[model samples]
Target: LEVRQCLNHMTDIFDLIDAGVSPGRFDLAREKLKKKFGEDAAILRMLEGDARWIELWIAVANTVKHPKKTERIVVNDLRLLPDRRIQLPTWQLFHSTRCLDAPQALLESADIVIQNLLGLFENLFVVVIDQVLPALPSGLQWVLDDIPEAERDPKCPQRYLLSIGMRNARHA
Candidate 1:
């Protein structure tokens, strides 16, 4: 459920960026983006590249909706530790395991999935911003100028901050 919610949140961000191109529903907006930007568009490419992550997210979401389907999905992606904690393939959630006990592993797994999805969203936002910024009105060009030199890169944390700020400003 939380994983699905996170994906929805990221989609909302994409919908916002796509509003100028297609003002209606998010599905239509995404289609418009694909039509306008072509198959090689950064957003489309990023999403296509994250197929495995999306599959896992969907499987988990389905399991949440239908508990009986849980067995079909690999809910044990993380290994439980002897200390009543859980560890991902690469990292261990020491504090979370200690605090939440048995459920902490599942929570941490959801978090990892959410973070991966957010990373894709961040990359897509950078691409969309790069494509849109230059076409903005001269007065609005100040927005990009206001971004710090370090945050200029799309992958930088500051870039995501700037993107969200711009998104909020547009909505307001």
Candidate 2:
């Protein structure tokens, strides 16, 4: 559920660059961008490796969000048996073009899932900062701000601010 939401948010970035791209359809967006620009486009090359992972994540998210009659294989918990062995979630892909013969555990732990999401976010941020933002009409781009002491948590140490000024400019 959360993964799906995060993917949707990520899709918004692509949509901002080119309107009419559907949310959570990064594959389609990639193809559209590649076709519009070219296969040799820098951003597309940078995003090539991320496409597979995003597809898998999309499959996992969709399977969990919209289950069918034979799609009841979402195990999402870590357990330790008396034998002292760790057991991770048994997440699998059901209806993805990735692998149709048989499905395997795509996501095992929350840590990995979070790490993947963060990695994708960082890559996207770099692409936006380097390529997308400068081409925007209003020059609107993201800014990072430190979390206030009153609202700060160890887990979340910063917040994003969308600024309308120069790149990396501190908005007062």
Best by TM-score: 2
Q: After superposition, how far is residue 82 of candidate 2 from its true place, in Å?
A: 7.4
Off by over 4 Å in 2: 76-108, 132-154, 157-172
Candidate 1: regions farther than 4 A off: 17-32, 69-111, 131-172
Cα misplacement distance, residue 20 of candidate 1 (Å): 10
In terms of lDDT, the best-performing candidate is 2
At residue 128, give the lDDT of candidate 2.
59
Residue-level lDDT of model 1, residues 1-172, one tens digit each, is 6666666556665544554432213345456668877877777767667765665555555554665521333334667889988666432221211221243345666577757866776676676777655454433432432455565765654533442234325522
RMSD after CA superposition, every candidate: 10.0, 6.1
lDDT, candidate 2, 44-143, per-residue tens: 7866877777776677666677777654444446778689997654554446454333433446345677777876776666555544555545555555
As a TM-score, model 2 comes out at: 0.62
Reference-based lDDT, residue 38, model 1: 84
